[model samples]
Target: MKAIREARGIGLRRLAEAIGIDPGYLSRIENGQQGAGNGTLHRYAEELNVPIKAITHEETPRDQE
Candidate 1:
């Protein structure tokens, strides 16, 4: 997520503001310390001008073995 966001030149704060999420929360999400819900994923994709799959595909299952 951070890679994609960086490639698109979207700053953390800017993306967070655009998606109505806290910068810290977004940072944690990007850092893999937190997970975002479907709605948040949609919000990120909308703000990033990418598809939801693009956002979702980047996330791995948290408890994957």
Candidate 2:
């Protein structure tokens, strides 16, 4: 996520404004402090021109092995 954002040269504030979310919220997301819903995930995928799967992925439990 940070890679995509930085690749586009967009700041957190700009992305938050474009997505109609709070910059603080975006900051939390970027820092792995919070999770985003499907809608928010799609919005970011659209804005970044990246696949939604790239931004939102399922976390495999350690016990799966």
Candidate 3:
């Protein structure tokens, strides 16, 4: 998440404001100490200009085949 944010040239405070979260909370999210619900994931994707999968780790059935 932090990588994507940095790659997009987005500052912590800027993204936090855009996503309606605190900068410290955003940092925690990026650090993997916290988890985001589906809605928050959408907001993060929208604010970071990335797909939700970019920050999530869901296993697809294809990988098990």
| Model 1 regions lying over 4 Å from their true place | 58-65
**RMSD, one per candidate, in order:** 5.3, 4.2, 1.8
Cα-based lDDT at residue 44, candidate 1? 93
Give me the displacement of residue 5 in model 2, in angstroms. Answer: 0.3
The deviation in Å at residue 39 for candidate 3 is 1.2
Report the lDDT tens digits of candidate 2 across residue range 1-65. 87889999999899999988999998898789999888888898899998777887654575367
What does the lDDT come to for candidate 2? Answer: 0.86
**Least accurate stretch of 10 residues (summed lDDT) in model 3?**
55-64
Steric overlap count per candidate: 0, 0, 0
- Each model's TM-score, in the order given? 0.82, 0.82, 0.83
Please give the TM-score that candidate 2 achieves against the real structure: 0.82
- Those runs of model 3 whose alpha carbons end farther than 4 Å from true positions after fitting are 59-65
> 34, model 1: CA deviation in Å?
0.5
